[model samples]
Target: MARGRKLDIEFCGFGDGWEADNKEKPESGPKETLPPPQHCLVMQREKRRGKPVTLAGEFFLSKEEEKALLGRVKKMLGCGGTLKEGWLEVQGDKAVALRHTLEAEGFRFKK
Candidate 1:
């Protein structure tokens, strides 16, 4: 069960000159475009405590971009991974698959 109540209220007005400060201004110029970074990423496999892990290195991504890319890779590969210092470590030997996936995402790899 619920109860409802009604109350009478008058208009609520802001103080003077509010519209002048709150008005939206149009942008003046077009945003400048920048080229993508040139990072020759590499994928290698390493053994950690009797387990295999794939290390993708040489990424030039910001912290937020690294986290997002790591999440996307984990989802696409159906594996768990983490972002390390300049490396993305996935819980498996997924170098080849990771290469293919990264290539699709406009990433280049070093031999």
Candidate 2:
């Protein structure tokens, strides 16, 4: 009870043989399905700093799916790209190439 002094204490009457038995793990929610081919994805080309970049949108994909798709597209195109506000931004005017690539993956595009 003194200033900065530790008190000797003992806890009892709680049964010494008690053990925790939480073994079951909680399950995660179901994964989301990507949009079907009938849903058209929108693609647009824009010029930034005198260079062209393609923006692919309207896929209605989750964040993980978008990141994975961006990775695959970047690898396939051998160029740098990023995900911005749920849209895929590839570095170049790759509208035609992106259209073919996404079409191969069963995705439709706006005419």
lDDT of predicted model 1:
0.77
Clashes (candidate 1): 0
| 92 Cα displacement, candidate 1 (Å) | 0.7
Error of 2 at 37 (Å): 1.6
* lDDT (Cα, tens digit) per residue for candidate 2, span 1-111: 789987765564446776567878664565355674755789989998999999887666777777788888998888898987657889998888888888887788878
lDDT of 1 by residue, 4-81 (tens): 855544454555444556678775455332222366788889999999999987676766777878888999999999
* Candidate 2 error regions (>4 Å): 1-33
Error of 1 at 52 (Å): 0.5
Query: Which pairs clash in model 1?
Result: none
After superposition, the stretches of candidate 1 with alpha carbons farther than 4 Å from their true spots are 1-37
Could you tell me which residue pairs clash in candidate 2?
none
* Global local distance difference test of model 2: 0.79
Q: How far is candidate 2 from the true structure (C-alpha RMSD, Å)?
A: 9.6
Best by TM-score: 1
The TM-scores, one per candidate, come to: 0.65, 0.65
